[model samples]
Target chain A: MMAKSQTHSDGDLGDLLRVRDGFVLADVDTRSTPGYGQTKSDAQDDLAAGAEEFDELQERLYAQSRENPDSPAVLLVLQAMDTAGKGGIVRHVIGATDPQGIHLKAFKKPTPEELEHDFLWRIEREVPRAGYIGVFDRSHYEDVLIGRVRSLATPDEIERRYDAINDFERRITDAGVHLVKVMLHISKDEQRERLAERLERPDKHWKFNPGDIDERQLWDDYMGAYQVVLDRTSTPHAPWHVVPADRKWYARLAVQALLLDVLERIDPQWPVASFDVEAEKERLAAS
Target chain B: MMAKSQTHSDGDLGDLLRVRDGFVLADVDTRSTPGYGQTKSDAQDDLAAGAEEFDELQERLYAQSRENPDSPAVLLVLQAMDTAGKGGIVRHVIGATDPQGIHLKAFKKPTPEELEHDFLWRIEREVPRAGYIGVFDRSHYEDVLIGRVRSLATPDEIERRYDAINDFERRITDAGVHLVKVMLHISKDEQRERLAERLERPDKHWKFNPGDIDERQLWDDYMGAYQVVLDRTSTPHAPWHVVPADRKWYARLAVQALLLDVLERIDPQWPVASFDVEAEKERLAAS
Candidate 1:
């Protein structure tokens, strides 16, 4: 069942993929590409075509923000399990655009200094400026996901983070940021194959972590934690999208489509030149 | 007038442009493109051609760092007065690379909380990770530039920051970072014209702060402050390159060339695969 009425040709992916109230992660098919009907080659073609449009739209957003400092920005938060293709999405989807227009931060293990501040302190510092597309690869959800399954934080502290994250999302959205939170979903079998391949490949050996396998063993617990996250933190302002990532091509295309949808809705335009164009051109030429 | 022996055809721009002992800000022509024998069109062609090479080199650097976490990173510190084209350099030079590899920080007026820490505390938080190209739009030099000119810090305190900066830079470089400090030099008349253009254009109105004119009034003092900065902090390990920025195209091209030189020197290669690649490929195919 869809959360919202279908409006677009591809149907509203946000409505279809968004985790609604009383959502269950287990019920969603990790192998299915909901509302999208395209072959892998077709998806590749569509993604390639969309790159130029995405680039132009990003530039427009950057230009508009530069001219009007109060303009809004977009933030795409990507969270996924190990081997779920988050890197591919970042490289293929967001990577096609101008680096000048993007603000990306990959949160690793918290530094000693970071742990001293409230969990949100470091996250707040990396929020994109006006007219930019800020991407967070594995965001604040880590505090809840790993913290919940690993019992890193006390139960009471873990409960507080959910509330803190919700409030933080609301505050950022109110301050003119369109937040797009994505969870790239892949099956256990798929992850196993991916990890196995990493072990077999010398080039991918560096990417393979023994810790990832440890977390994989606690998969069900992590899933339960994610269920709670979907229930608690998926607010209207910054709802989470459960993107089936078994097909990397489909997932990258879908993410790009989602970004395009948001940018279309925002409809950022290049600011009209405020100076006399002809006069300025003449002056520049003379100079 | 060479500070170091020439090693390449480009004649080691790092050596030529570097602020050596007894460096005079006034002696360096703001309009000159020293050691670069190219017209504006020729520079543009070179920049376009080098973009792909720069992107590839950056990716290799990123890959190398990802594989070997201890690998060094490059930090490019850009300092310039209002309308001196720091934004242009960022857009043209660094913008051509992967956003994922870039760590860009535009230091605004520090927050009340930031001021509570040692000034370098905020700077340290924003330092680029291993394999990243960290670009600071305005950096630690601000403390000396504004602090000395406006007397924000006591004479003794201002003197202390110089030593502190040198020590801090040495520590970072020792910890595997190649620091490249750049100051975009523009003449008083050039700045006045640029300021006039900003005022003339309504789109640029947001960029033109009335306070810039106030700062312009004290140009001589700022220049004196910059002279001291060049003299006191231009260490061999973390030397400052003063780029003549009157020509925006030339400045952008020169900055890119400078970055290319640093990257060339670093010569990062893709890490050798530790695992059996053929086995991984077969496993991935089978899976």
Candidate 2:
């Protein structure tokens, strides 16, 4: 219904953005609008509209869990190069709902304890409980992505991790958790502009780390790792959406729309009153 | 600068709403927009503007923490009667900032594990980590309020909790944690209308517990418990703000204003660049 006939055609955003078996990371034009044909302002309006929907749906999800603890929950996994708008999605998109229902975990460098265990051990502990929307800023995929690019893990170890991740995600999805995986696709030139801007502004200095330049130098390796990931781990239960993130507004809009699509499908209903209404009303009136 | 000249006059909102030793719960006019002199629509406009300021100030605080891990963090302790709009504050007020920098805990009735430890033990663990905004929807105050009213704890135990709370708060403040304690004061009539509405709306029934009526019956005791709480815990380190809750907008605006005032006073600065700006820009441009 939101599909406009200006510069874009119609299809579900989930279908439009999902990467199947042969998606080459280099083939995606980072600046292309893809499924969205609207102007920037229109997308902004849609974002606001979608946010209201997210709040209502998320609240229902939260409410349903209160009635039934076994109710379905959602997990949004965000993977991206540095400055690929991961935090922006957290702020402007998921930030629209109640924080009570949103469980957010930002995985930084693994701690000494985390390094000692299987990589997914820390991740397993932080999975969103029922009736909550869980968001992972950087996830277990880092073990495969950075783990591959930096030789942090051996080739055999990296090879087994893809299957481990698929198995883990399958387990989560089978347990009634809806998983939405996103890889923010930004072009090398686009990253240059972003990094350059960060350097140009003193206010954003805290966000810029020298290691970012080192990562930039290994962009192709990261892209290759991402491609390998999509080929190996894009399952029916937990499909990955490769969102073009050169435009911050578009990335936020696409993710919001996709999430709305999933929430709509889940269709969490308002919980039924566990107590008798008539008796309660009379008692309330007396009180 | 956000102070409206009309309904709300010129002193800081922190000073305007802070309760001192002689404060009485029964004397507060729940429906009055005490410090907010503006209409509801005007207050809504201020809320939006303040959200933007909150975003900026909060980012500065977050950024400062990245540079110095030992930076000061904020904790907003919300203690309210049911239907006093604590959830609304979490969704609307604290919801305005980045989730990465915000830590929210909604403490329900403690489970057996929580009861096994001291009341403040669970609370001690979740005190927002360094450089974050921690929000407790209904916090440790529950220990005293419900504990005192229901005789859940011994009378002697109840007497010791006041000093326990003060000492705990003092330790927190001394360790560079700024505590903003709020008690949402609603009248008996207001509670009836709110509870009535919950019972009336099918969608709101999940929020209504028959137990709420039981608690409503002890309104006088809860009020007495609150009076003692304000009398004891309202210290210079963590002063309590008694916000009139019948007017939701004013309570939200006052709390947001109070938080902003603290952030303004803290004056989190832009971190100085650790790397050479020109060198990074040149490297970025070349990449």
Candidate 3:
């Protein structure tokens, strides 16, 4: 699996980590940081350095959008099992910049208002503005994730959701919103240890829930649901990156690097000011 | 001014930088990095290190909100003249984190759709979701800034907007959006130099505008407009921080520090998971 990931360049971490056709989610190591050949501390330092540049590129995207409304925005959808560190990614990766440029939504149990509409209704409302970054902690995939695992939705409905999500993402990308879907993968043992730690810590008690055990009973079923999700919904326009998330620092760094790669590809520039500079300078000097 | 800023503890940069009653925007030097007695390089390093911690706290805020919808969001409204580096601040200060948690709006010329409604209709649509950071690049304040300088709105209407803005912000704060308004102030000489630099580079020519000079001719008028804006709308819920914009690094660091201070005060904690952890752990281990 590592060898397969190594075929891609280090710079294209997205390609290296992205799930392609006939990919096996189970084969990928949850502890591996493919394409990045650095120590944990070194990766941390790189992430810190890259953050400044990321800020610049994100700003350029924002500036271009201001000058041209058709400019593109980026959306990162994080899907993971409870305790897989989706929250950590949201904080460590996306939290580095000014809160002003981000749009974050953590999908919870559908409300009465939400159930009245299609599952995608709430998601459509939260897409990032042009040049902004939109993050979904858990997303429409939930309808398929827990829905399939818990049999909350019928098979036909789950299938329809997969199609709906693909179409919805395509429409978004066509309208200049780049989508990066990430699945944070952790092993059963790692999760057990994390859960035990949560139980041991008084401060972490709020973060633990007994319901998670009910979900754990269906781990294989949940994995099957995830496999189906990765297979059906990971389209070319909105490919899914299955990040090995046992190591939180590496996961955060990889996600950051992935976003940086996307922003660099977009290459948004500072929009040319549409006003007269020479005349303005002279007039200002005179004033 | 620097001495006054230094009188406060380092953690209280927000209060140090905030505009209060009888505050004079012009009296604040545009070159000083108040409440932060570090070199530009040191500040940059400090900002880099703090970026991770900032991301964590912001995530906690978002997490808390997810667990409790009534949790507050922070809104950073940036107002500045062209070439004052609002773009830089948005990128450097706000851009460092996950774009997922940010809601950024750069208000430009109102569209036919926008013109049909109240000036704030568009603004209301863009307010940050709960637990998110909302950033306005040239926000509703522009209604008064340009509206006053260009006389786009009648003087009576301008006065009415001042009142309207106050009411609107009061409502926003009342609804749990902690607003941190900032004005990036630059001098006439600095503006000339930046404009000239913009003209000298083809890559930057796109960022140069002739209309900015027309506005430059009314720099004093704009200053008076900003002063009035600060005086009328800088309420307790949403105070204005007039940051010195001559040094881009210093301004970015100061604004970031100011936001950090606000987030610290809000101090959002990670939400406790609302499930049975022990049962879940046992079920998982057995499985």
Candidate 4:
């Protein structure tokens, strides 16, 4: 199912995966840093307004999907580090979705039963049907991210899974499932701050895992793993959108934009009127 | 916290429960049904329009939550029998929501560790924060539903849980969490039809579980179990809506109406401008 599709020129993958020593090594300091290279002074204002406008468009698209039940489905996969705001993104970015049509599956550490099947079996069962949308909090990408970071998979095995993911995602898209994958990028400082907050707040305590600190220690290793994962798996069928998540608004805006763009591309229709009105009308006239 | 808030004067508990069971037990004949009565004609239309409307409103409510960072969170829980459309409703209803501010958690049979805690503990941790929405495909209600259905909990034990659930939900609401519960009701024949279709279709085979049919055989018992569950647990704070799932549209619409009503009540805000230039300028000129 692999498409010898053109490279990332049409998408944001190349720039998104730019990294060194794995930590998304970039000069992403928003406050003191100058604006995104080519954008204008009012880019922020424009971006915000554009996001809201896209939101309006999205509302309509969603309504259209419901009104016309035959519309193609939307599937979103979120892959991120522990404190990288996967939960935050789900809470904030897609917060406005209709609960009836949105399917969310969160893949945590696999259970013994889950381990019995091939890695993607659980996810395969959870894919949204046509005209629906599915969001994976942590997706099949785990095979690469955690596996590579932990060195659980051999180098050859990691490479093979990359090809496998490419094939799997291509089949889904070929079957008309529009896919969007996002990697929320947060700096070490931000991670530390959020981790502390999770620990400090009583209600947030449930979210804190001491294991996350251990993962944080391997930040560089994970970054190296993500760089290769991005390079190998970012395909035309399902490209990655790596948003700067330290600043929440920008992250939300980027995700919304990517969704709007893809959904509009595969704009689906509600089922056609089941009964033929003209035929019924003709029969009535003849009677 | 229990307000005998008797807002539901639409009908008597017994009558409504009877109506509920009547609707569930109503044969394939929608033409002349007891609970449906004359409500059938408009029921089809309402189902169609209602499902779409519910999805639209849910998306908007979720969006409002995201934009207004301080808005109270919304929790949507779906508890129902097999093939009752828990997965279907989640997909069709909330699919359009922005992924950032919405959290979707599906609870399966308990893991060993999860079984260790009180049923509510894991679910409590999964609730979305302020300015977010959370949807549970199965939830703490399992403590009552499955516990009662499987006869795992005695009648007295289940009775104590009613108050505990009320208190737990009340605490969530008091903490600024809005709760919405939907019970999707599908007739036995429709379920049989659906099961047959799943068996016939290759892609749908994964969804077909023989266990679902086993549960269906105990349909009447499940109905009585649900009635008790609904009666004991439906409080003024988090009243339960028994959605008619025979027509998918009606199921979606009723859910939408409830969601829109709740969100309108919440009325989340747009962020206050950091710099209100007009007001600042006016003050400066006056000075």
Candidate 5:
């Protein structure tokens, strides 16, 4: 009887693994989704090629705003588990951007002052102005991830937050803020390799916390928590793109594609000059 | 008398150029100073090499902290003219540092809210916690530069700010924050070239504001302002390193060197546990 129960558990695990892998493949190919890149490839080399194209697209999007003073603002939220490569994606995809046009805010464990306010208050303060891009590294998603994992909030309260975030994102989207959300997902085995690498590499050691292993032990809990996070918050206006983060470059490229798609959708145009430059030139010539 | 006056003016211009060139060189070299690295041939080369080395050093520093848990924090302050390479340096050098351990804050033209408080208030709020690095792009030196150049303060008032800034640096330094200040200097001709390049480059056209040229016309005044900024704020605790701006790579390398130098000074050691591993292992094995 015990052996039969063990077999049943193993079968359930295998099914989950298959489903996760399927999502990984689907994410790379689904270009029809709004704010997603159309070009899809599974090979590492193809992903890199796509990355190069995506980078050029991003530069052009930034250029669009520079040329046109009235482009709507863009806010990109990146939330993921540890070793999900948030900084790597930021540097690879967003590093070349004009610093004046991009703002990066990394939210750590909330400070005492931040805790005193609502979950979104600190994030609200860092929103990019119109015509600029704001990138959040581990943003307000923490409210759900940490709060739910620890049972810090009641079930009803958690449900309310899911709605609150949906409403919040929609309001920001309506108010000329283009919101793109990406959740970087990595397999448990991949996460183990990454954590081990951080432990072995002296330079990466500072980022390693033994506490992370404790969280790793709670892997099933986190997966369950993230499942809830994705299902509840993935709305039409600010749907979450679960990027496969095992390939760091691919994740970055995918993010860039989403950004470019949003900016291109805006179709920014240069502001009109109040006077004619040719007439002024002719006046000066006549004088 | 006219000949003597021309000679004096020429000497003044030469002194100004010498000081300006010194700043440009120091800014480039300082980036590499915090780590072991070679000086580059030109600004572009310096930035590339400096960036690579700075990234490596940041990783090393973090690794050291994780291993030892006692590494002193490194604080980098970037001060430069409007188009100086502050943003680029920031993107390249600190770009790879773990976002959790790195704090980046841009001090823009003071808002009304900022003006209500002391000049250092905003900065105080952004200082990194223990075991973290803080990078400030345009820091408190504006108190001396803008204050003196615009004559917004009386001579005594400017002098007081200098003293206050010195005190501020001393306090932070004494409290374990290693402060490295860099000033990026560009020639008037280089400024013209950069401004024109922005206008001519389709992608950079938006970065070009005609008002920037208006500020360029006050080149002499701004130089005087920087000279005062340097003289008044260059305390032994936080001496300013001026880097040449004509070569961006060289400036990046210089900055990297300054960072490595400070990190090497505070080589953090990982604390070892005093427990008997053999006994613990045996107990675990038996269990």
Candidate 6:
């Protein structure tokens, strides 16, 4: 069930920002508003409105899952440059819903046991169970992104992963997972400013990693790798959306709209009672 | 570091609601707000105010955990009869914080694999890693409560569980986990209204179960089992609090206050940066 409704005046932000055929990473302006004509205040207002809608839709999805064991689950895969507001999207966008309904996993550097297995092995274990909004902070895409840039994996192995990820996405989405893969696109100039800001604040230091600068030095190489990712894995069932990261508020608002699109399409209805309500009420009264 | 500042004009709700010495299960009036002197509007205003404070305190705890591997974690254990608003507490209270900082687990009937091991095995697996606020909707206390009331386990098995729970709690708290054990105390009359209301609404049907009626039939026995649990399992490390839950607002507010107290005591400070700040600034600018 593809979501057909559009609540925003600019139409579906997902469609406007999606990486399609002949997409180029460098060509897209990081600071552009793209489809949104709204001001920062408008974005904030829309985000708050979207959050309320998300909370209700999430509740419906969760309630539907209680009876239907095969009820569909949504997997939101967030891949971004450092300080592109992945954490903010989590807090400001999806954070308004019932915490019980959301399953959040931040994939860090693989543990020894995780490193021993196929990349998808660790990832598949954490897919949202039925009726959940599963979020992967830095997902399997890392195995390819960082893996490709750092030459951590053999070229042959890296080549196999692109297809493996495509195959994996196809399988899970076929098995009732609505995948919303996002790449938060920020420019090198924006990266320098963000990193500098992190360094400026003592409270923010714990979040600033020296390695992020090390990665920033290879900006061109990482951009090419991301382009390759966008080209190879942006498929029908699991297409990737390129959210401009320079505007933190816009990125979060866009992601929230994308999720709302999916849930609205699924249209999870409240489950009918499986028991005799009249008899139960009588028994409940007696008790 | 114990949080000495309380926003509530009424002294610490944690102390007022705590199941302390000479406490009697029958003595607490489920409808009464023991120390809170306010109208429902006042409770609502206070609850809205508490959510903002909880948000900031939770952020500090999460931030501390990032820099210090041995940072403290908080565990909230909720127990009570069905319809006592465990889900409500999860939604309205903890829902106000960053979902990344909260780890929520709702214990169900034991799976074959889980039943294969000790009761605490499944529990231990789900404990919040450092720098998190972990919540257990129903926990190992079930082994003793349901195990005793339904004779699911022998007297010998049930008898062993209480001591086992206390020992397990003592060990975890020593390992930098702050335990907040709460029982949402609701009267039978209040429960009947809640169940009837669920029966009255089609959207809420999925939550209503005939099994709840079966459990309701054994209310006194379950209360007896609870008394035994409070008597045996409540310890210095993991004391229990009975929040009169006839008023849903008070229960959620009280649980939030109890958590604030623990966080206040732990007082997770913003982590100190490990790197040379000025050097990093130069390095970041060059990149």
Cα lDDT tens digits for candidate 6, A180-227: 999988889998898888888877887888888898899899899999
lDDT of 4 by residue, B3-78 (tens): 0102312322222322232243333232122233325456555545544544444444544544455568888888
> What's every prediction's RMSD, in angstroms?
6.0, 1.8, 4.7, 13.3, 10.6, 2.0
* Model 5, runs deviating above 4 Å: A1-70, A95-101, A196-206, A247-249, A267-287, B1-47, B63-70, B92-102, B131-133, B199-203, B267-287
Candidate number with greatest DockQ: 6
Candidate 3 lDDT tens digits, A120-191: 999999998897888899998999999988888788988899999999999999999999889999987788
What does candidate 1's lDDT look like per residue over A128-212, in tens digits? 9899999999988999999889888899999999999999999999999999999999998899888887776555666766667
TM-score per candidate, chains pooled: 0.77, 0.97, 0.80, 0.50, 0.74, 0.97
Sort all candidates by DockQ, best to worst.
Answer: 6, 2, 3, 1, 5, 4
Give the lowest summed-lDDT range of ten residues in model 6 chain A: A1-10
* lDDT-based ranking: 2, 6, 1, 3, 5, 4
Q: What lDDT tens digits, residue by residue, belong to model 5 across residues A1-287?
A: 11221232233211222223124223443212222223334324443554455444444555566545555788989887788888787766666454445677889888999878888899889887676788999888888887888877787777788888888888888877888888777776677777767655544555666556666777678877877777677766777777767767556655665665666567565433333444433332332
Off by over 4 Å in 2: A1-9, B1-7
Weakest 10 consecutive residues of candidate 1 chain B by summed lDDT: B1-10
**Per-model fnat list:** 0.22, 0.90, 0.53, 0.17, 0.10, 0.84
lDDT of 3 by residue, B1-287 (tens): 12222343364577777888999988988887777777777767776766666767776777687668888999988888899998888776777666656777878988999989988999999988789998889889888988888888888988899889989999988999988888989998898888888777756775676777778878899999999998998888778889888999778877777777778878787777666556655665686
> How much RMSD separates candidate 5 from the native structure?
10.6
lDDT of 3 at B229: 91
Query: Model 3: how large is the Cα RMSD against the reference?
Result: 4.7
Candidate 3: which stretches are off by over 4 Å?
A: A1-21, A32-75, A91-105, A124-134, A167-179, A202-206, A234-241, A249-287, B1-21, B33-42, B45-68, B95-103, B125-133, B174-176, B236-238, B260-287
**Deviation (Å) of A132 in candidate 3:** 5.3
Q: Please give the lDDT score at residue B217 for candidate 3.
A: 78
* Candidate 3, residue A197: how far the Cα is off, in Å: 3.3
Question: In model 5, what lDDT does residue B233 have?
Answer: 71
